[model samples]
Target: MNEKSGSLIDSLERQGVSRRTFMKYCATLASLMALPPAVGRAFAEALAKATRPSVIWLSFQECTGCTESLTRSHTPTLESLIFDSISLDYHHTLQAAAGTAAEAAREAAMKLNWGKYLLVVDGSVPMKDGGVYSTIAGVSNHDMLMDTVKGAAAVVAVGTCAAFGGLPKAQPNPTGAVAISDLVKDKPVVNVSGCPPIPVVMTGVLAHFLAFGSLPELDKLGRPLAFYGETIHDRCYRRPFYDQGKFAKTFDDEGARQGWCLFELGCKGPVTYNSCATVKWNDGTSFPIESGHGCLGCSEPDFWDAGGFYRALSLPANPLHVAATAVEVGAVVGVGVALANRAGKSAAKAGHETATLADLEK
Candidate 1:
């Protein structure tokens, strides 16, 4: 069956997923999202009984890098998440069906799961000349987006293009490109913005939705608070060098070899909010700054149009103080969680029922 409406556990079991593996996957998702350990079991239980979610992924003016990044995730591989947990009925990049067959699959999925399927979009919608700049099966990207979203339970704008109008929306603005949010005014959207957003973060959003039947808490920009709460500078490995006003003047400078801050070289870490610093990439190997490169701030809205690359941004009047406050923000979340835990313990004799940020680290 292309789309399963049966118990999810049975579906997973048929796909060779063990009960223990499913439970562990749920636990990992809980930890990844900074939820209590108990929540993992709850998630497992809920997801087991839940119907496998039908997903319809639309690709417009995109490089397909977002799908590539998602496939490279190691721990929770793309196969385990997409094939086992959800029915990915349509994704031009990954699906074998083509042309008419592909469009038919999408329409069938939408018809079967109307007002229930999760819509995942990964490109900017060009409204220029009535969206003639981009099309899928001769249907304008704008029209397709408008039509598909009407039945989506929730929409996930997976890359900066879909979330913030990425490179397509860059200066000159020839395409009249706009984000999915611009047209998806009625449905709740979860934006995961990056040139290619972190894979774990992408899956985490899907996991949250599957387990809870709702979207996770979002920042003002519609990004998940759990992953996009802190600025890259706050969690960056080279942040200490930034605090000391130490930076690499040029690519070959001693500071560069010493792994000093790259802010002077147009690192947008200080202003960009993402998990690149903390989660790293390629299975936690390293991020851009670790490899002696500056952050391009690909995660932020209008990053491409902000200014040219390799040019230092106008420094904040008290940049160090601001960075210091950013670091303190995590400590505050931990402290608040601790205080709440104490009160809960005192009131109900339940010891450490909630997972604090510190606890989640474990």
Candidate 2:
């Protein structure tokens, strides 16, 4: 099948997708990319004319969890449909052609789209013993990545393994696994670093690329700021509890039952950055914190070695300068209280406005 022969709109229209549906998808993509609302229409027009870009997906020394996260957790939404719009020429896990045929397809796509294709990697590359630990068609993963990325326009590291070495590069480091950025220096690399990034986030990145012909603005970690800009703690619904110093001591405690902060129970939300709290998983059902568990900080680098999961970040310790510590805590708490008071007042005022004049006169 000639996957790259037509524009995305052509493919969608052929697939029975309405123009309105496509426009809505484009708008959603715009919102996900944090682009202004006006850009949504621009995105629609650009994407309609944009040809489906050839994509080469590479997997190395890691589990297929990232792929599962992208495919399994969501209903067949427009985001998943967008995947169909891209000419995903290579993906060992999903491709029908196997072995030599698959390898031939990848080589052909790379040759045809050289310097214009997107190379997406989902696993870390093993660098030990001439990269013998992981190989495809007897070709070392490290060598394949190096050779493949040479002609690529941009490389997207799709999971923690591809972005930060992940569990494979954790303590002991048996495979000597390294992230894509460590090896691919020439191409602009975007890291979507999560144990398995949110499905919409995965598609959003691809959509942004398709609409803008460039990667979205990224943070220091090479992760798109639209998705990884804020800490989970900052976005968590229970964050007010943290500011108020109301925390759950035990999993089944009243505070926990009341949906108070889980910081005392070893939540890593404060340090973790991802769209889980907002974009969520399982079709926007709930995230870990919403399910009453603390964040595992899976999105950050070397999270596997970030101490015990059950150890709280705010553990009390004897401070040499108690006065200084108290002052800092007081300032934070004061700000929290002020914000809470303001929110409460706003809500109360809104409620009062809803009262009818007839009731007021009575």
Candidate 3:
């Protein structure tokens, strides 16, 4: 076999990752994905004999934050997901080649691996004026993406920018920026959406692909369900505080100091989907909520244009009105919380005002 040709386990072994550790990783991933233990063993076996796939990373109309998230953060370390598993053939930020030679390298990798390589795009593609807004080596982002995607086995739209048109496609989009999904209809596109998606989430998606040779189960937005299955609100530790109506009205208040829910302070966690609450950042240090800030809902589409960051989700401010609205609207998903909070604020008036989980089900 050639230098780049080998099973993943063999390379991991050479790189100092033990089989026991690798298997443990597999088991964790399997459980995280809601798969049986047998599937973990199957994954381990599949990766042990599978050939490393070639990956081409393209960047356009974006900050380099997405690149930094994976390369700079060492969690789910490079030895397991990046360096030893996939042959990353082209990455604008990481590769050493420049100018014509760089373009040549991309062309060569595409030609050699034709129809089998993975295509990863991290930024939005500008469509105005034939994509003159953003270019690499004098080639437009639109042109390059279309040309490269022609030969890719599957396309991974990393970060919210590439997945949902992000900031580049915000109101008054000057560049006419568009997401990868808007362009690539023929290929199976997997959207990993986050401002800079959790690093371990990126790792998990890649690992699933390497083991199964197919994209993981996806949500309605084409995001991997393994990672995007629950909203940040679902896993947030402050959920109990929200249920109890113990809200921090401002950045500095008794409730705020007590670590109450940030919902009233404009947290979009209730509607936003991501793994930030669980996976976290900076080596599992903490996320925005953990550090006393509300979620900006950066993972969902058009979060940039969603409105003021400090503007709380639209709901009834008065408990009496909330109760009326809940009855009028049939107590929809979010209305239940307001009704529950009614009991917290006026415990003496009526104990029956508390909206039960069973009431929510009804």
Candidate 4:
């Protein structure tokens, strides 16, 4: 049955997926990866006849949000089906096997598909005291990762925890947690990082690998450049507002109601890089900014320590220092403006008065 199920086309047909739908999914993945339209056709052809690679998912210190993000909101969709179609030999959260049987299954799959299987890990591995903080089947996560990565074709760190130590590695970290890269030096490790990474981004990486037999081009942080190449602010709907310096001082203010920039409210969109603004969430309904909340910078490393969410990044940490600096700048600018403007002041005032949302509609 496993051999018969190797063909993705046969499996999809059995699941009642039409060829048209499959092709559409391929096109979507191609676009997500920033590949040309021709590559979409190539992706379809490659995935249709290719044999599914064995995948072993290892979970350590995490909230299970990464799995939830990928599975929820899409019912029998192509993305979910593609994930299901993969030869997932072992996953602690989703696997039916437990105890000795589960461990045996993992071992069998590793040995059978050695040097060709994919190793996916979520959550950080606690390295303190022989990794006592997290263990599976009496084996430390550290040991398991080391053993598994050696035979795997590639390693994908799925989520901020696995990629960058996330919350578990936050200040005063008790577990002495570290990311997967800290341990795996030989293997090519792709970091799909977010508090819970975008579901499509996760699958897009998989699709690219399936079609090309290698991982996509990555950024310096080991993130797929297709998704993490641009700052969220660069693609945000409120980008015009940001350019015009029209900012919302408070959540309930008129500027906010008008959908002005949330920078003053500590939006991390400018500094944070992710596909949130473009791809969005909940079936493209909205993202956090569209839902009237400033970006929490969930995708960036050390976001938890980036300071208070409500405090603007431009402001100094010390209130007195910020006040004094603001006053000084204001006085200097005011004097300069007075000295430079006479008849120009009237023209500037007129221009300012005429400025409206229409001026920055784009």
Stretches of model 3 off by over 4 angstroms after superposition: 1-5, 74-84, 315-362
Per-model TM-score on C-alpha atoms: 0.82, 0.85, 0.85, 0.86
Instruction: Write down the lDDT of every candidate, Cα atoms only.
Output: 0.79, 0.81, 0.79, 0.81
Q: Candidate 4 — what's its lDDT?
A: 0.81
Candidate 4 lDDT trough over 10 residues, lowest sum? 353-362
Worst 10 residues of 2 by lDDT: 353-362
Worst lDDT 10-window in candidate 1: 314-323
lDDT of 3 at 253: 70
**Residue-wise lDDT of candidate 1 within 109-189, one digit each (tens)?**
999999999999999999989899999899999889888988999999989999999989987889999999998889999
- Candidate 3 residue-pair clash tally: 0
For model 4, name the residue pairs that clash: none
- Between 1 and 3, whose TM-score is larger? 3
lDDT at residue 231 of model 1 (Cα atoms): 91
Evaluated with TM-score, which candidate comes out highest?
4
TM-score of 3: 0.85
- Residue-wise C-alpha lDDT for candidate 2, range 157-267, written one tens digit per residue: 999999999989987899999999999887899999899888787787787788788888899989999999888877899988877889775577699899998765567
For each of the candidates, the C-alpha root-mean-square deviation to the true structure, in angstroms, is 14.1, 11.6, 7.7, 8.5
Error of 4 at 29 (Å): 1.4
Ranking by TM-score: 4, 2, 3, 1
- Report lDDT (Cα) of residue 80, candidate 3: 37
